[model samples]
Target chain A: MSNKEFEQQLQRSVAQLTKEIQPQRDLWPGIEHALNHEQDSQPKSNSWAFQSMAAAFLMIGLFGWLGFNQMQGGDRTEQLVTVLSEPYQQQKQRLLASYANQPALTDNWQQQVQELDDAAAAIKLALKEEPDNPALLKMLKQVYQQQIDLIERVHAPAWQTI
Target chain B: MQTQGQLVDAQEHFAERAVLNLIEAVKAGDKQAYQMLYQQHLGQVYALCYRLTADRALAEDVTQEVFIQLWRKLDNFRGEAKFRTWLHSVTSNVCVSYLRKQRGWWQRMFNLENSEAMHEVAPGSAGEVDLDSLVQRLPERARMVFVLHAIEGYRHEEIAQIMDMAVGSSKAQFHRAKQLLSEWMGYEQ
Candidate 1:
């Protein structure tokens, strides 16, 4: 054949081969089965997807529940701290009230006694504000005799430890 | 606009009722329509696949996958582009993704005698075309362009989009394909 006709023949051949390589007729049954099974198998796949989604949602809900409880626990601790501090504040006020009630005398002996009582009350108030404070209580005990001496001169002369 | 062009356009387009019917049947879970549609359009899709993979079995597998995916996604088909065009796009995309996954398969499959390459052909009264030598010799990208655009009737723009190349590149590839075949057969310039 002439080259021009040969080229045309080649193009024709190429086009012909394109048509012949279709999927085999035998595989069509398998292909059909595949399609039918595809129809049959879809519900199972959907069920799996739904189950996974539900599991995910359940886990999320569990975490949310735990987190909410943890936040509530933190709030409870804050409230307890506030409640526990109130009594210390009240005790400090009571100590100040008692000190205010004591009167001063004209003599230095009474004045010295009143000063000691004032110091003791102040120390006690400080101790109540910080209930675990041992330093202030220790200081208060060191000067306990001064108040006792004044009180004994006025009333019980034989009281020794004050 | 042009009266003569309008007449030619009218001649090229056919009522797409068969495609629509098959789509409806497949949507209704009719396996018969699925098979008929497969039989009717398998050549075009298979040709597209073979050109992309250059391996017959892989092409067959991709063809199967394309049909499977078509069945699965049948409900998503709206009447946008022509059904055949949409099928081509889907087939081409699936072939590309398959190529990415099966690089080793491609290397091994094409490693044999170059004479065994699959050829793109048209339906005819004759039983088969002698394609082993012609297809074995054409450059890969050129053969794909020729098969997609010339034999399969895809426009250059469509081939470019499907193959992810520039439109100019598809045009150039097609021209080079025609030129190469003509030279291989010793045709006149």
Candidate 2:
């Protein structure tokens, strides 16, 4: 037989090929299980973010108060720092617990919060040498507020926009 | 009254619309709608997977992976192309990736001499051969090129892109596939 005739026979056979074939077993159960497993593990994966943020905030508050005592300038600075941080730490813990089940709106919100905590720590370290330094106190206050704003923004009801 | 051709067209249109609705529901996170879509397309996806992988068990695993990926990526479909076309593209990519990950299995099967690869002869006259069985017997690249280009209606350019080879190589593999298939079918030059 010529190549042309052979090609025609091949084409006919190709055209006759079935487009669908049923699998010997049901595959949907496996796929559904995988998808559900993914959904179930999502919150557990985000648990690390919650832990990191909580640890960062605790360190900043602890370091700030410790620095106030080290300076020994006056009891007023220690009192003020304690007043500012005590309630803030309580609120932070509450918010983290409440939002533990919810996925964060942003991937790097925890990182941003950690950076702010680092800034707060450095300011507190400076305050240790000059406890009455108003500029450093203001800066520390700004950092703390920024952390609160970030946490609130990430878990806000309007998070869909973010 | 509609003509027979018109009636068939209307039915097809209705089916197409139903599939689009299911896609929209799936994008909205409706699991039932996704299951409906799965039941509707599993056979077609499995067929592509089976032909591409050339192994029943591997095909089953690849088919499941394809659906899992479909669930994750259904949101990316912008309706610019027919869903089935997009799905076939997805299945082809998944099969290629899955096969690449199972390179050891492919190496074992590639040695067709030791591999009990082509045992299912077509159930017909003694000389009649199943094209799919013959395709499974072809060298891996040749089988992939022929299946994509001839059976799946992919152009050599598209096959090259999908298989990550040069277009010339795609054409060469296809030519080699045709020659082997013709020879296996007992056709002379």
Per-prediction DockQ: 0.15, 0.24
On residues A18-47, what C-alpha lDDT tens digit does candidate 2 reach at each position? 989999987777677667665554564466
| CA lDDT, every model vs. true structure | 0.58, 0.73
Q: Quote the positional error of residue B46 for candidate 1 in Å.
A: 2.8
Which stretches of model 1 miss by more than 4 angstroms? A1-21, A29-162, B1-15, B80-82, B104-133
- Looking at model 2, residue A160 earns an lDDT score of 15
lDDT digits (tens) for residues B1-189 of candidate 2 = 469889999898898889999999999999999999999999899999888878787788778778877888888888788889989989888788666544433253235423454334424322455788788877777888888899999999988888889999999998988876766776766
Cα lDDT tens digits for candidate 1, A78-150: 3333333343334334433533543311124455556666766676566556654545434554344334323
Q: Give the TM-score of candidate 2.
A: 0.61
Candidate number achieving the greatest lDDT relative to the actual structure = 2
